[model samples]
Target: MADYLSVSALTQYLKRKFDVDPYLGKVFLTGEISNFRLRPNAHQYFSLKDDNAKINAIMFKSSFQKLKFQPETGMKVLVTGRVSLYERTGEYQIYVDRMEPDGVGQLFEAYEQLKRKLADEGLFSRPKRPLPRFPKRIAVVTSPSGAVIRDIITTVRRRFPIAQIVLFPALVQGQEAAQDITRQIKRANQIGSFDTLIIGRGGGSIEDLWPFNEESVARAIAESQLPVISSVGHETDTTIADLVADVRAATPTAAAELAVPVLSDVLAEILKEQNRLYLATSNLVKNRQNQLNRIRQSYVFQQPQRLYEAYLQRLDTASRHLNQVMTTGVTDLEQRLQLVRQRLLAESPTRLTHDDQARVSRDTDFLNRAIQQSLQTKRQRMERAVQSLDQLSPLKIMGRGFTYTTADDEVMTSIKQLHPGTKIDLHFADGLATATVETVKPHEEE
Candidate 1:
């Protein structure tokens, strides 16, 4: 029993042995990742495995934050960390301090991931703006000493010398280059006068042009109010900035060409327009003069009175027709007046009065007959109604030997309403009598 040790004691001893070993303290391992799940704002736990075996790996949040690319399951990676044993679980694992993609394939994988993420967010799907056909002031964001700006300036000067060029110097390489490029883009916009922005650098390796691929640079280009023309690296190179910009150019010289029109071509077009205007003005003046000549040669101008000769003849014929119409209209009116006078005499007041008097006499007789018949009908109705009411009257009922009694000025309908010695009034056909109730009894009791 003295030689036996508990599981906890053995685990602790092994953990210490793994921790203090110098080779295990900083081991460089390369293997394929397995079971890797990203835990936002927390530590990552996964396994690194080769064909021979597998080892569990853990990366704390602080160390994982420094990773340049996302680590995923089945991705080959080179990790530098330490081997340590867990006392509680009795498992040996690697605590990764640093990790990176194993090869170029991994870097490309990271680029694809970012590309897909930005695409999902509609950053690449946004409508691209059209570059100004003739930019007055172009802003260039690139290395001040680079050949990119030189090519742009030379092309712009050779083509459109009157157009101004403003340079916003920025670092086009290295880690800090993305931030500087973004700042220059914003600054150029803040000035509020630049018509177009050209962002680029000379030919370089992917590492040298990585800043243009950065998310910050892409976002800045996408959000720019001014149109952006991206010309980065060689003709074959395309970056995130290029994808988001309003226009993409293979070289800086090509970008300048897109930004402004050729000075000679524009001047030639203006001269051509001027010549066309002169030709048109000459043709228009000649056409108008020819029309004036035709008008002068017309018969109306030759005779002068020919314009109103038909009107004078029309006036003479119209005057004779109007006089004849007036004579015929007067004769018709005279005949109508005589006919109306005869009709007036035929409808004189004397005849109308006799007819009106006869109508009144007949109406008076009819009214008198109607009044007599209405009075007779009302008198008959009253007699019948009086006879019916008399039949049902209390006086009439008393005359038939039936009487009613009232107690407290109300008719007594039930024997229960009266008791012995109750004062009551008896109403008969010819008189009303007063009496006191001696004995009140119902018909059943009687």
Candidate 2:
């Protein structure tokens, strides 16, 4: 065989061929993506596949950053790049410069992706806040020197001059404008004075109005505490900020109109309501006056005191009836008393006779003597019981030169209860004595 080339040499030779070939330098391809993963702030590495073949692909961070849509697995996409050999790995792959969805533009794909993401996160599902019927203080967030600001100011001034308009000028376009809009929104909340917020800009192309579609601006509008009115572009244009805002108006002037009530219309409504209230009050007063007059024509009102006359008459009649009933009750009670007196006089009091009184005296004397005898006998019996108790008491035995012995606080009555080295107590009439026995002597019965 001829001299064999090393792997590195072969790879370098192939790389030179690819670089010189104009067709390999710029190749456009369409395929399904596979093994696609986004590295944090780094380049992307993935594979592009079709039904019949597959190829390795890479995109540097610079090119990836310029992509409008994120590349995902299984996505059909078109890539514009060059095929080159990686000499160290000896692998030929495509280095992509730009990418887009296969059939649609990257912008449209990005729009769909962001819309789906926000929808899944419930950003668009939140309840829209109602606008104030009459805003007192309104804040406008837009460019200071634009037709949007001018239109808003003019519309609001013509509609409701009483409302105070505060302006928070912000950049409404370009790459850095999303962060600016977000900062202004937070600043508006920090100030905490405006009743409503209007964030808007004049109409422009999709690329020009892209700041309002940015995720940062959308998040800012969603998180705003104030009721946000979005008027980002023309009637035909819609942005993510509009989807997330509390209210969306077609134009800047419409946003302003929605923020505050029309002064003339409000004044006319006030006048109408005032007239309605006056007529209601007048009718009420007239009705009450007529009611009073009708009441005055009534019989009770005409007679003045007739309402109470019947009650007074009934009270007088009741008083007379009460007096007659009391007189009859008194006469009946007097007759009953006289009849009882006669009956009492006609009969003798057998319970109070002389013989009964004498018998009671004799019984009382007998009871007194019996009570005295019983008390004396009970006294003698109690004294005998007390003497018996005193004689039988253990303390009385102790007084007779007898000693009581105990061990461990238990009374010991037998010699067998003695234990050597045990503590013992000897109780006497005077006090007690504690003793320890060195030897036990159990007594034997003779």
Q: lDDT: which candidate is best?
A: 1
Q: What lDDT score is found at residue 171 in candidate 1?
A: 97
Model 2 agreement with the true structure over 288-347: per-residue lDDT tens digits: 999999998998978879899999999999999999999999999999999999888766
lDDT of 1 by residue, 107-167 (tens): 3455677788889989888998888777899999999998989999999999999889999
Q: After superposition, how far is residue 30 of candidate 1 from its true place, in Å?
A: 12
> In model 1, which runs have C-alpha deviations exceeding 4 angstroms?
1-137, 164-166, 186-195, 202-208, 213-227, 233-240, 313-353, 367-446
**What's the C-alpha lDDT at position 112 in model 2?**
73
State candidate 1's TM-score: 0.51
The true-versus-predicted C-alpha distance at residue 270 of model 2, in Å, is: 1.5
Q: Alpha carbon lDDT of residue 69, candidate 2?
A: 85
TM-score of 2: 0.47
**Model 1, total clashes:** 0
